[model samples]
Target: MSGYGVVIPAFNAATTIAETLRSVVAQSVKPDAVIVVDDGSTDDMAAVINALNLKVRLLRQENTGPGSATTRGIAALSTPFIATLDADDLWLPTKIEEQLAHFRRFPQVAGVFTHWRNFHHDRPDAPEAVTVPGWSRSTMMIRREVFDAVGPIVDPPGGRGEMIDWIARAREAGLVLDMLNEALTLRRIRPGSLSYGRDAARDRGYLEVARLAMQRRARNRTEPS
Candidate 1:
């Protein structure tokens, strides 16, 4: 088995899935296994994946939201190291190689994230850096044991803003999150993306994450440190 595994949570990502898969397959240090979780996509995403035949695994499940799909994929991983790449995102050929090196150099870090360029499908020339506090899923490579230690991602009620909740839980578990400071991924920003249209929901998610992180910090201070 490959020492590393990648889990991709996809939903109707026909437009970009092929490119994403190719990017991973073409990596200098390919993952031992790559899993694509088809989260109840109504489109031809299945067909697209089947056509690749790149030795990657595909898991199909009913629409359970990205957080749950990701959780399931993490459970299915058999490697010591696991990374996440959304189906709509593209990774550099050296993404995995760089992350593995970082993990080796810093064994105590539970996860590593890289800088990424953001591009809109319609506007490819105007690629910009994605700068958000905390972490972005597209850039993170995590140790499988981190999940076992912290617990699986908890799906929030109403199936909204679950990613925020997952990240909060990780920080609470004292996982050392490190940034590689290299652009290893490209995130596609669609017109009506959650970062754009769902401003209110995104803000609420950010607030929740900040509050939990602060509370955890306060509690840590009160402890015998």
Candidate 2:
């Protein structure tokens, strides 16, 4: 209910991770811990982290995808709440403060997500207007119970859709999830990022996630009350 930490899943994010961590450090509510799990990054992530002079734990592993990296970061934290941030995103100074306030207001919700806007990495000065409540992992502040009840971010084959599966699974498990209307995150839209370009593999992951969700729904429908 009180303590929270930050987990960042990185894959060759050395160029952008320092700024991401800076955003965390700028939060009004300081995190209990911060961990970055590098998923087989061939970059000098260690050097970048060291030079930043910020308190961050760096963990390295083979290329397992962002979901696995995120779960690893989550497991390494010893806090009641876990907030995730992508290596290429930035959180406004009040991001954590606003989320913690939402928790106090809801009292019973398992997770809180805020709206976000995307900005081109090269044109950081030209951020788009905040449009909608984005139920993204980068915008989420969740209780550890959500994972304990549901599970870690699904590692479907390929690029994206794992978070979609994660959110769906959380809902199926009857967890109380809510999102704030306030935009608190700035997503960097850059080339070479996982979500930057769509491909067949990404689509395949989507199909797999959808199938799994449908199967879960069917199972729930058949289960006796």
**Candidate 2 lDDT, 52-93, residue by residue in tens:** 999899988999989999999998988999999999999999
Q: Give the TM-score of candidate 2.
A: 0.96
lDDT of prediction 2: 0.88
Worst 10 residues of 2 by lDDT: 123-132
For residue 68, give model 2's deviation from the true position in Å.
0.6
TM-score of 1: 0.85
lDDT over C-alpha atoms for residue 167 of model 2? 93
How well is each residue in 128-191 modelled by candidate 1, as lDDT tens digits? 5563432666778888888788776654444456666676678777789888777878878886
Error (Å) of candidate 2 at residue 164 is 0.3
Model 1 scores worst on lDDT over the 10 consecutive residues at: 125-134
lDDT per prediction?
0.79, 0.88
The runs of at least 3 residues in candidate 2 whose Cα sits more than 4 Å from the true structure, single-residue gaps closed, are: 127-130
